[model samples]
Target: MIRSVVFDIGETLTSDTRYWADWARWLAIPTHTMSALVGAVVAQGRDNADAIRLIKPGCDVAAEWHARRTAGQDEYLDETDLYPDVRPALQRLRDAGLWVGVAGNQNHRVGDLLRGMKLPADAIGTSSEWGLAKPDRRFFDRVAEWAPGERHEIVYVGDHPANDITPGRAAGLRTAHLRRGPLGHLWADSPAVAAADWRAISLHDLADQLTSRPGGAVPAPSM
Candidate 1:
């Protein structure tokens, strides 16, 4: 049975479109233009550090954009919204005796976001704090370590296959792909055998999947 359920933040529990768009607009560039710029950076075939170099110049651009969007508004950015079903789903998992946690490629500011959303503080993991990002074995290994008994009775649910599902599977955890968009193909190649939607499957479905098969690593799927 699944003892824990880990969630990815962006594109899973929360939407980041406004934040990014506002950032782009602040740079006096069109939203799509900024996206294309970032895409080009990624296409350069560089490591994360190199990619950061290409994008870091835009940090000031992002901050200025956000400043304009939030000027005289509120202390916290209101651009982020929790997915409609997210709070309920997390409650369902917690009520069903599962430890609900968050794992995401976020920085320390994730704590502020969680607090703003009234989410539990203890159930979060950010790359900034952990010094690791998703798809890295160390990220999953840390989650495994934090769980009771260092066992793999866990299920990680997220929208991104490359960032969330792949690493969860690699670390020997069951995975659930939240097919929120067109990226379902990404998870199709993961060790996870199931994908679900808010309308089609509940947290109970994930728990059921884990209960049926515990502790054995499934073969990687063809991505």
Candidate 2:
């Protein structure tokens, strides 16, 4: 039985449109350009840092983030940044006696953002504090530490097939590939994505499945 559900931050539980738009505004580029660049990167299964580097050759991601912080931007998520389905889905999971947490390749500010938003999460971990990012087995391993039982007792929900689902499955956790983020529409037919234990268009679908299932153990998706 799944005892914990850990989620990815960007494009998974939160809609990052405003966040990315902030970055674009700071960089003096059109927001649509940045949005398209992000989608392109996701479609190619590339990293966001790598995409940023490509946009501004020789740029430093950490330095850019620090600059944004200094400028009083990129601080936290606004109320409009979160997806409509996130709160209700998380609540439903908690009501079903399951642990809900957030784990992702996000900066330290994300923890503050989720907390400020008053999310009903048991724990929130980010790459900045964890010193590891997704697709790295260590990240998933860290999440396993917070779960009740063995690694398989947890389910990882996220949008990236390569970064989220692939490594998660390798770490012995069931995976849910969400079709809402950058990789959703473009990579839907990819072989890696097809292997996920579940494919959901929204968190609500997963919530419904867990609530209906005995012991909150999500069943395999019908082929």
Candidate 3:
């Protein structure tokens, strides 16, 4: 029986466009150029953090973040940053008595950020707190711990094929590939996503999957 649904935060349940655009502004890179660089980073199997240094060598990201915070310009997510499908999908699952959570590779402040935004997640955490990043089997092991279920009883939804789908599937949880983030859009047609237990254009499709199968039975793997 599927007992829990855990979603990736950036670009899965919420859009990080504004935050990335802010980084672009701070770096003085054209918005479109930043977007392209992000795609390139993903293609190279690196996280977005690499883009900051790649664009400007020796740029201290932590220092820049502190400066932004000091200037009252820290990038923070609000309700508006959430995807349109997030609330309804979460509500639907919760209404059906399923536990929901938001977990991803992010800074330690993510819990506070989600709380301030009032996202309806039963649990939330970031790599800073979890001590592991996605695509790492240990990370999904931790997620399994959080949900307190057999691996098959949990669903992990995220936009990154390599980061979200691959490891989650390997860890024995059902996986859903959501096409939303830059990596998501870039890899939408990739075989990694094609092999996911579910391929969804939005979270609503995930809700449909949950409600379509009752008694914790997972729907058949489908695109």
Q: Each model's C-alpha lDDT?
A: 0.58, 0.81, 0.82
Which 10-residue window of candidate 1 scores lowest in summed lDDT?
195-204
Best candidate according to lDDT = 3
lDDT winner, 2 or 3: 3
- Per-residue alpha-carbon lDDT of model 3 for 136-156, expressed as tens digits? 899999999998578888999
**All candidates' TM-scores?**
0.67, 0.90, 0.89
Off by over 4 Å in 3: 214-223
On TM-score, the candidate that comes out on top is 2
Q: How accurate is candidate 1 locally (lDDT)?
A: 0.58
| Local accuracy of candidate 1 as per-residue lDDT tens digits, 54-138 | 4555445345435654674222333336666676667765666667788788767664667566663247778888898877889
RMSD of every prediction = 5.9, 2.3, 2.3
**How many Å off is the CA of 81 in candidate 1?**
1.7
Ordered by lDDT, highest first, the candidates read 3, 2, 1
Give the per-residue lDDT of model 2 (tens digit) for 88-204: 899999999988989898877787778778887888889888999878998988888877667877889888888898999999888888888667656766787788777777788
Over 4 Å off, model 1: 32-80, 120-122, 181-223
Once superposed on the true structure, which residue ranges of model 2 sit more than 4 Å away at CA?
Answer: 214-223
